[model samples]
Target: MTTTTTLEPVRGPFVWRGDQLSGTDEWIFRLSGDQIAELEDAGRRFVADDPDLRFVTAAEYPLPVCADAVRVFGADLDSGRGFVLIRGLRMDGYDDTLAAAIFYLLALHLGEPMRQNLLGDVLDHIVGVSDKKYLEGGLPSRTRDKLPFHSDSSDAVALMCLRPPASGGLSSLVSGATVYNEVLARRPDLAPLLLEPWHYDWRRQDPNAPADTYTSPIVSWTQGTFSMYAGGDMIESAHRYPGVPPLTAARKELLALVEEITYEPGVALDMDFQPGDIQWLLNYAALHSRTAFVNGPDRAHQRHLLRVWLRRDVDRPLVPRFGKHVVVAAPDARQVGPGDDTGRFRIADAATIRERWGD
Candidate 1:
C-alpha cells in the first residue's frame, strides 16, 4: 500500500473486544415481527414476477423499515465495529423460492453485490471444499479443512447459516486494528515488514487468471485506513513458486506471533452461528476463522452456509495492490442457484457440488 503523510487513529468501536461484542445484544440486529412480516410480504410480491430471481438493484426491492437498518448496519461495518449478526429470519418450511428471494432482497439493503471470484460468482458456499488431502492457497471454502484467519478479497463479506455441523464449527473474529496496535507495541521491527508488499499463489483457485500470483502487504494502510491481507496457506503457497521471495527466518517468527495473537483470548470474538443468522463483516477491518468439524450422515445433515460478497464502491478507500485481480460481473449477469447449471456463469453447480463436496 502507498504511504501517506497523515495517519488516522483507529476508531473507538473498531477497538472492540470479543467478550464485549459476544456478550451483548448491541452487536446484533434481530428482525422485529413487523420487519419480518414486511420482508415476507415483499418477497411474496417479488416471487410473482422475478421467477428467475435475478440479481436486482436495490431500487427493485425496497424495504422502508429495512432501509434504515441496512444503512446503520453498513455504517457499523464500514466505520464502526466492522461486524454485525442479524438473527431470527425463520427460514424453515417456507416456499424455497420465496425464502431465497427474501434473503437476497433483504441483503441488498447492505450494498450492491460484488463479484466473489474471477468467474463472476456473487454467491458462494462455505463448506469444507478445500480438502486437506490437497493443500492450496486459493479457494479455501471448497475444502472442509479448517481455514486460517484471513481477510477475503472483497469490501465486505456476508455469510448466512442454512445448517450447522454436529460439532466444532465455531467462528472467531478480531479487529485488524487491535492486531496492528499489539504488533507495533511488541514487535516494532515486524510492523515495518507488514507494510511491505509480498506475493500469494492462486493456482489452487483461479488458474485461468492473468497470472498465477498476486502481491500485497500482509498488513496494509492506505488513505488512513488499516487493512490486513494475510492468509497463512496462501503465503506458504507463494513460496512454492521460484519467482517469489523466500520468507526469512525472522519473518517466519513474526508470522508465528501474528497467528498467535489472532486467536489470543480477549482479542478475537468467537460466536456460533444460528440457523437463519446473517453475519456481515467489513473485509478491511476484520480477520476471521472457522474450526474444523465432522460432516453428519449426508448432504441432508451436512453443515451448509450461504455467502454473499458486497461492495460499497466508494465507501472504503483501499491500497492499489487490492485492485490487482478485482473482477466485476457484467451488469447483465444473473444469480445462479443450487442444481442449476446453465453455464451462464462459472459457479458452484450441481455436478461440481456433488463431485467436490461429496455425493
Candidate 2:
C-alpha cells in the first residue's frame, strides 16, 4: 500500500474540570429516577423483542429504532472525540457490585439494541482486581511501558469508574486517522512500516503455549478508513526472532515521530475519570491509553474500573497478516495453567513466568 504521512490538523484540548463534563447537554441522553426505571422496563421488553438475541451492526438498528434507548447515554456531543461519560445511572440490583448497576443496565440496553451481545461472561471477565496476565501479559513493565495509540478488539469499549488513583492513571486518546495523516505529512517514509506485519507478545496467553510471540501490523485500512492496535511491548517482542529483518533506523525514527505527534497536547485528549462515571469510546477509530496509576492506600479502595469489549460489525476488516483471530470475547477468557499464577496483575513481571509456573 502507498504511504501517506501527513498528520491531520489538531482539534481542541477540551478539558472537563469536574461538573462541566457531567452536564446534560454533553450526552445524547441523560436519564433520572423515573426515566431510568422506564429504561429498565424497556430493556427487559427489548430483550424479549428478539428471540435469538444475536449481535447486530449499527446500521441494522437505525437511530429511530432505539431512539429512547440511545438517549439514556446522553446528547451524543461531538467534541471531535466521539465519547461521553454518564454519571450515576441507577442499577436496581447489586448495589455493591464494582460496576455501577446503572452502567451495566445501560450497556445491556445499548449492546442488545445494537444487536451486539451484552456478553455476561465476557463482561465479568475483566471486572475488579482479578488477573491481568489473563488479559494481556499482565500490564507491561516500567521501561517498556508506553502503549502507542491503537484500538482494542471491539467496536466500542466502555469503562465504568468505581475508583480512581490518587495520582497518575490519566486516560489519553488520539484520533487514529488524524495521527495517520500526521505521519503522511511529517514523515512519509515511515508510514509504510505501520502497514507491514510485525511481532507482538500475547502477554496474557497461557504459559504452556509453545510461543508467547505473535505478529500483526500497526495500522490497517479498508475502503479508505483506518484502524490500529500499535503497542510498544508487542513490537519489541519481534526483536527476539532470529534472522528476522531488524527495524531500520528510519522505521524507529518514524515510530518515535508518530508518538511525538500523537501525544502532543493539541492532538491528544486526556481525561481523569471519577467514581460513578461511565466512559465509552468508539475504539474502531480512536486510540486510547492510561498513564501509570497508583492505587489507593488500601487494596479494597485500589484504582478499579470495569472494562467491556464489544464487537461492532460495521467497522473495517482485519488485515490478513495482522492475525486478528480472536478465540474469546474478553481479555480474561484464556485458561490458566497449574502454576502460572504470579499474583501480580502487571505485565512487567511476565519475564518471571517460567520461575512462577515451574515445570
Candidate 3:
C-alpha cells in the first residue's frame, strides 16, 4: 500500500483536560425567539416536503440548505475544527417528536458528512443510555467519568443533549492528526504501526455474524487528508487470530502515546453540555470522549443524547483498510426488531426508533 508523506494537519479550537476542556460559550447559531420560530418552521417545511425524512433519517441524510442557513452555521470553518455546540435551546417543553425534528434540522443545516447509513441507508440514529456494562466498556456518562479517546464510525457524529447528568458528564475532544504528528515527532518508529490495519469489534452488528469484527487502520491518509478511527479494546481484540503478535508492542505504545498527547491541555478541549445543546464533531479528523455522569432521580431526566453518523461529500479517497462504503443487509435477511440480537440494541430507523427506547 502506498502512503502519502504529507497529511493535512488536524486542528480544533479547544484543548483537553482530565475531565474538562476549554470551551467557548459562544454558539454557532444562537436562535432568538424569532429565529427559533423561523428555524422550527423551516424544519417543518423540510420534513413535510420530504415525508420519508425523520429525525434519524435526517441525521443520516443531507438536506439542501438555503445559503443563508449555511452562512449562519459558518460552513466555511476549517474541517479539522468542525465541532460546534449550540446553546440556549430548551428541551423540557418539547415533545420527543419536536425535539428530534429540531436536532435533525440543525444537523442538516450544518452540512457535515454523515458516516453511517443515515438517509437512504439504514439505521440512522443511536441512543446512548447509562448502563453499568456499557459504561465500563468506555461509553461516556454524566458522572465525570474519564473516557478514553476514540473515533466513531462516520465523517461526523452529532449528539443532541436532551438532558445533562446532575454532575460531571463534561465533553472532551482531541485531534487525531495532532496526536499522530506528536508521535511522528517524538517517536517516529511507532508512527508506521498506526497506519497498519487492525481489527475492531463491530458493536453495532448482528451477534451471530462471525464475531462481528472488522479490521482497519488507526490512521490513514488519502490524497492529502487524514482519516482515523481508533479504539483500544477493538485493536486489542484483533489478537483472536493465530499468528497475530500480542497487540504488537509498538501499537500499544503508539496508543499510549496518542492518548497522552490527546489528554494534554494544548490538544484537547472540554465543554459542559446543556439540555437542547448539540455537539457535532468531524469523527475522522478528531477523537472525543465524555466524563462519567450521575443521572437525576427520574429515569426520564437521565442523561440522554441522540447520535447520528454522517457521510459528507468530499474529495478524500477511502483508505484501504478503513473501508469507505456503508454495508447493509437485506431487511428480511436480518431480524427486524427494537434491539440487537443481544436484546440491548437500539435500531436507527427514524420512524420507529423512539418507540424502542428503553426509558
Candidate 4:
C-alpha cells in the first residue's frame, strides 16, 4: 500500500470547476420524443412480463433507439465529465411500479445493477423516513439532513426523481479531480495523507455485514490515473467502533479542509430534482451531496427518488484495496428473486425499517 505522493496537478476533462459549468448544458441530455416512445414501449412490455428485475439483463431489455444516448452518458461519466443529467420523461401517466421499471430499464443499458442493501434490492428508494443524521446511526438516504459530498460504492450510481420535495432538496456534485488539484495547490503536504488508508464504518452500511470496519484510501493514483472515494462522514463514524484507530489532529484537519474545498463557490454544481430526471455519476470521478428538505404530510406527498448502483463492464484502474468490500453484492450476485430472503426488493415501510435498523 506504499507509493510516492506525486504532486503534479491532474489535468483532464474530469478536472472541472462547478462555477465554470453553470452556463453549459453539455452535461445534460434531454431525451428525444422517439427515444421516449422507445422507452415507453419497452417499459410497458417489460412490465407486462413482470420479470424479476434482478435477473433482467441489458440484452433482455435492449434500448436500440436509446442505446447511443446511454453510451454518451457512460462516456460523460467516465471520460468527459463526472456526471450527466437525463431529462424529458413525463411521469404524469405512470405509477411508481412503471416508473421503477423504466428507471431499471435505463440502468440496465448503463451497467449491471448492483444490490444497494442487505435485502439484495437492486432498486433503492431515497425517501426520508426520519429527520435523523448519519452520525445518529441513521442512513443518510433515509434522513432529511444535509449530506456532505461523498461517493457511493459502485462504478456508477444513478437516481431518478419520482417526486420533488416541497422545498430544499437540491443535489450538489463536486469533481474529485478538481478537489485534488485544489488540495495539491493549497496543502501539498497533506495531500499525500489522502492516499493513505482511512477506516470506514462497515456496520453503517448493514448491521449484519460481516465486518465492523473497512479501510481504503480516499484517493488512489495508479499508473498515472487518478480516482477518489470520499467518505469523510463514514471515516468519522468509524472511530466510534472499537479497535478502529483514532484520527490524528493532522488527519482531522485534512478531512475538514477537503470538505471545506468542496463547498467553495466554484467547486459544487447544484441541481433541483424533478420527476423523471435521472442523474448518473461515476464514483471515482466525483462526489455528491443533498440539502436538507421538508417532506409533505404523508407517504404519497413525500419527496421520493429511485436509486440504482451499477458495476460497469469496463472498470477503471485503481490502487490495490482502493474500494475493496465497499459494496457487498447479493450472495447469488446475479440471481436475486422473491422468496430467497436476501432482503426486500422494494421500499420498506416504517415497521420494516425499524425491524431491520432498530431506529
Model 4: per-residue Cα lDDT at residue 314? 77
> Of models 3 and 4, which has the larger lDDT?
4
Alpha-carbon runs more than 4 Å astray in model 4 = 1-5, 298-301, 324-339, 342-359
Query: What are the lDDT figures for the candidates, one per model?
Result: 0.68, 0.50, 0.56, 0.80
Tens digits of lDDT, candidate 4, 242-276: 88878888789889999999998878988888889
| Per-prediction tally of clashes | 9, 27, 26, 1
Better of 1 and 2 by TM-score: 1
Model 3: per-residue lDDT, tens digit, 1-359? 12334333344442223233344444345556655665566555644554433233433434344336445444422352556666656666665456666676665565432323211322243334434344455233212356677777666677777766677777777766667778777776677777778767664332333554677888777665666788775566556655555665666777777777876766677767777787767667668887766767885656667665554555556576573222322232113322332331222234234333322
Expressed as tens digits, the lDDT of each residue in 191-295 for candidate 1 is 677777767776644666666678778766767776676776677777887677788876687678888888788888887887778888987778898887777
Best by TM-score: 4
TM-score of each: 0.84, 0.63, 0.73, 0.91
Give a tens-digit lDDT track for model 2, residues 1-359: 34554433333422222233434345423446665555455444433342222232334323343456465343232233456666545543423331333344455445522211211223322222323431244432221123456556445677766556666666677666677667776666677777777766553332343565667777776544456666654566556666556777777786678678766756766667766566777664567776766556764445556555544334346667543343333433222222223232221221112222211
Using TM-score as the yardstick, the better of models 3 and 4 is 4
Give the Cα error of residue 261 in candidate 2, in Å. 2.0
RMSD of each: 4.3, 8.9, 6.1, 3.3
TM-score-sorted candidate list, best first: 4, 1, 3, 2
Better of 1 and 2 by lDDT: 1
- Worst ten in a row by lDDT for model 2: 350-359
